[model samples]
Target: MPRKGMRSLCFSSPKTLAYAISRFPSPSRSTAASLTPRPSFNESMIQQTIAAAENMIVKWNPDTSSFAKVTSLFYEDRNEAMEFIKCVNGLQKAMHLMVTENSGSDNLVRSQNLMQIAMKRLQKEFYQILSTNRAHLDPESVSARSSRASTRSSTSDYEDDGTDDDIHAAGDCISEVEHVSVTAMENLRLIAEAMISSGYGKECIKIYTIIRKSIIDEGIYKLGVEKMSLHQINKMDWEVQEIKIKNWLDAVKIAVKTLFNGERILCDHVFAASESMRESCFAEISKDGANLLFGFPELIAKSKKSPEKMFRSLDMYTAISENWPEIEFIFSFESTSAVRSQALASLIKLTESVRTMLTDFETLVQKDSSKSPVAGGGIHHLTYYVMNYLTCLADYSNILADIITDSTPPSKLHLPESYFETTDSDDTPAPALTIHLAWLLLVLLCKLDGKAKHYKDVSLSYLFLANNLQHVISKVRTSNLQYILGDEWITKNEATVRQFAANYERLGWSHVYSSLPENPTAVIPPGKAKDLFKKFNSIFEETYRKQSGWVVPDSKLRDEIKISIERKLVPIYREFYDTHRVTLGAERNLGLVVRYAPEDVGNYLSDLFYGTGSSESTSLSSSTSSSNRRQSRSR
Candidate 1:
């Protein structure tokens, strides 16, 4: 079934693939070498809080049914505990009930409200918890300012002298560490809230300072991860897959409340960190030190089960936004435009890189093929990236079209460098195909009803690009195929690309246009013209209709192409034939102009290529049949 330019694909979800860790079982690698543990300023306060939370865990374990399973999580059976206490408050689950329980008995309801409030407070102060400690959730926090003190409250805890400030100041004297485990952070939150709800808000400063100076600076975060044995790693692998069995929404809601709590101090820190990482990445790209992508051998790795167990707090939420950008703010209830916009900006960058890759693949292929020591990377990489790029854009197409319509930028979609600037010419300034320019074109395309439709827009772009590519492909001489697909030439460090044209007879392009007779006087050689004809045949035969998948073009499309050539090229060629007479013979070759031809022609030669003038044109016209006969014989 001959067809052109269509491929029907049936894709499967990437999730079906299984993932495994590269680490060995019971591997005896030392943590000190792999982890550069740092201390937090609040280390002492946090440790104190954790110790207190551990005590609370011991006390609460027997009675706390809601968190009972969590507490026993690190153990194979029912009785063990990991070192850190986690926040299994299931915080978001409480949001609706907090607002709805307003009509109940003030004391009875308030106590419940306080517990709920305490959890909210707990998550805020503590941050994220380590999975190992998820079962024994530390109290996330205490109520903002409780009216009634806990019956078990300490007298010194509620002291109004602000004396804890001195202890907090003392935290400055301790050595610092790097990275805090979400688990350790959660322990601090529970302790701080417990103390405050017990009437010790003034003591909060000492707690924060203790954590900052000792734990944050010292890096308890790195240590917690480093502490994980091969067994723990293996356990984590199970937990990720098992999350689907639990109420995932419950976990997500809790996370949203904590991360989006609108803390001025913490928000700023997050912003600073994200911006710094972005800047560093950009600078590295500009400097051309991106070794992982280009020079190094590529790895085919899939995400592991329970991937979230290993993600940082910020990444977990942001990834949700990436997958569901349209409903992100709605689901998380984060009304801040800056936050939403930041998410969108991140999505935009991701989309742009994806766009760059999809567009520049041909160039990459050509370059890779040119290398002397070829890297035999398979089509799997290309297929994977293309499908990923398309899937992401397709999912977000509605959001993108909406944004494009509203933005003042001339184009709706922004493209990377490789799209318009096909040539990095020395004679002129690099052609302006900047990202902003591509956006202008996208904006225009978005306004078009056809392009605004799903899959239509992408297909429209593909066809348009393909058409222009055909023009460029047509202009390339068979001789210049070497220069055209540069990388492939370099890979062999040889002129193998020329073979795309050179193997015409063997490849059958030569046979397709074998009707043309020799005309050495023409600007292009008879051989070259025949090859060009072959290339035209190839665009349909070898390149398009020959794909390994489904395709069928409309009959009218083929007919229209024939009609177009009749209208455009046939008349043009007719005029050339009438005026040029395009006559030549071997007798004119042999010595002066042509190569060592007629000398070899003496060997029972049929004929040789030569040009003809006015009288020669008469002879050429009269000899057209004989000339055609000679060309057929040469064939």
Candidate 2:
């Protein structure tokens, strides 16, 4: 079937084909005699002419002469060019037959070269024409010029001297070019869609790639436009260019989506499991608990590549906005919005999968923490990765905020004004995007909070919470995120950390007091003293061995926790010492029996979080004194 605007060149009819063949001028007898050595070249010349005609399907406006050029052996005659509407169609059919019948002949090779030559010529001409007449295609330029013309006419008392005829001519040129370009774009779109439908995705990719490069070239021209001032350029012109860039980006986005869609760009080996597979995993792990130890490695390995794919999906759209300001202008709710939405949706799905994987991994860590400190290390690594993901989310959300706020009628991004209360009189109220991001951060923190509870050891659990919470708080405070979350939110999280610290101290020191004798009235019984010493040694050894390996990460919080534990256990040890020192005097070694002095007990507690406790012990005492002074002053 003939393509649109090509019915006149009806190559399907025998009479039309004969007419097309007749249009090809025969070689003169004199010319043929001169080519005696190349006597069989007449058929080759006809094939080449057909190929050239086929390639001229898309004509270039810039290449045509102002005066009519004479037809040559291959060039279209001016009258025939108008007469043959489907010139490319007829020529393509003729070339196809000639190549098919004489597939390996030198004539076919010459035809191919002719076809290629026509392609390059037309492509170059198309690019030049689009570049030269760009302003004509831009609605903004037309609008701005018309506005200026109107203003001039009004000032001249509506007198007409045809001075603005050039502007009118430019408008006419723009209208004509706009029609041609629109038709060209539609044809390309159809071809691209057809390629995709036929599973020629790579071909489609190449097509869009060329389109993007061409549009970028046009953008370079647009960018070079000189303005009297930064804001002096016509808004309509900018808006027009923005639409053009967005249209191209939108097409590229679709092409990319086609490449990614329905193909498992993700390593679905981790998340998308059949019920049988899941059951088998559970059964295998249950049969030999050791299998559970290496199970997370597979999950982790599978997930490791997923974030990168997800990032690329997001970067596909974001990179366009970064490179092209015109496309960026229409990002949020305009032509590029669908592609952005698709990219964001893919990102969200990937992140949610990551969250689920981490959640399950945390469960494994909790169950394994008692058996191996390796589990704790793994959790820390996972926590760091999760933090990196959250950082990406925060940065991308800021970009979304900028886009959503600037969208037509404004997108505000579902962030309510009531969400954030202004903490300082001078501080500006947080933008909707910031508040939206703060909420996302909160959701992640809450997820981490749930994961922290998986640790069997109370101190390890508290340490996990402290490290992650402190990280979140520090990030918010250091970045622009503080304005959204506010000082109160930070204070609240700090208080939660203090609560965890208190819990850590309470659990860790619980056994210390129980080791003291109930009655050291006169001389404590030898058996009771022996039991007391043994219990004290047992608890002290256990606490130090376990907690010394755990980490708080934050120096200040670690010190505070150490000091709190010191205050609880120190006085108890001193009282117990003063009460039972004489009773335990019969022991040959008092140092071994009492185990620790009051100061030594304080030192041990100071050393509980991390091994560098001696310096911290001194700091603890100073802090205690300072705190006491502050309390006294308040009183």
Best by TM-score: 2
> How far does residue 81 in candidate 2 sit from its true spot (Å)?
36
In angstroms, give how far residue 194 of model 2 lies from its true place: 46
Tens-digit lDDT track of model 2 for 143-243: 33333332121111112234235334444645554434333332232232222222232333433334333433344334332112223223235444344
Clashing pairs in 2: 140-236, 140-237
The alpha-carbon deviation from the true structure for residue 54 of candidate 2, after best TM-score superposition, in angstroms, is 43
Give per-residue CA lDDT, model 1, range 182-263, as digits (tens).
2233234334434333223333433333333232222222222122233433445455423421322233333233212212
Model 1: residue 486 alpha-carbon error in angstroms: 27
Q: Which residue ranges in model 2 land beyond 4 Å of their true spot?
A: 1-306, 309-379, 402-439, 517-534, 578-587, 611-635
Q: lDDT for model 1, on a 0 to 1 scale?
A: 0.28
- Lowest lDDT sum, 10 consecutive residues, model 2, at 262-271
RMSD of each: 27.1, 22.0
| Model 1 TM-score (2 dp) | 0.21
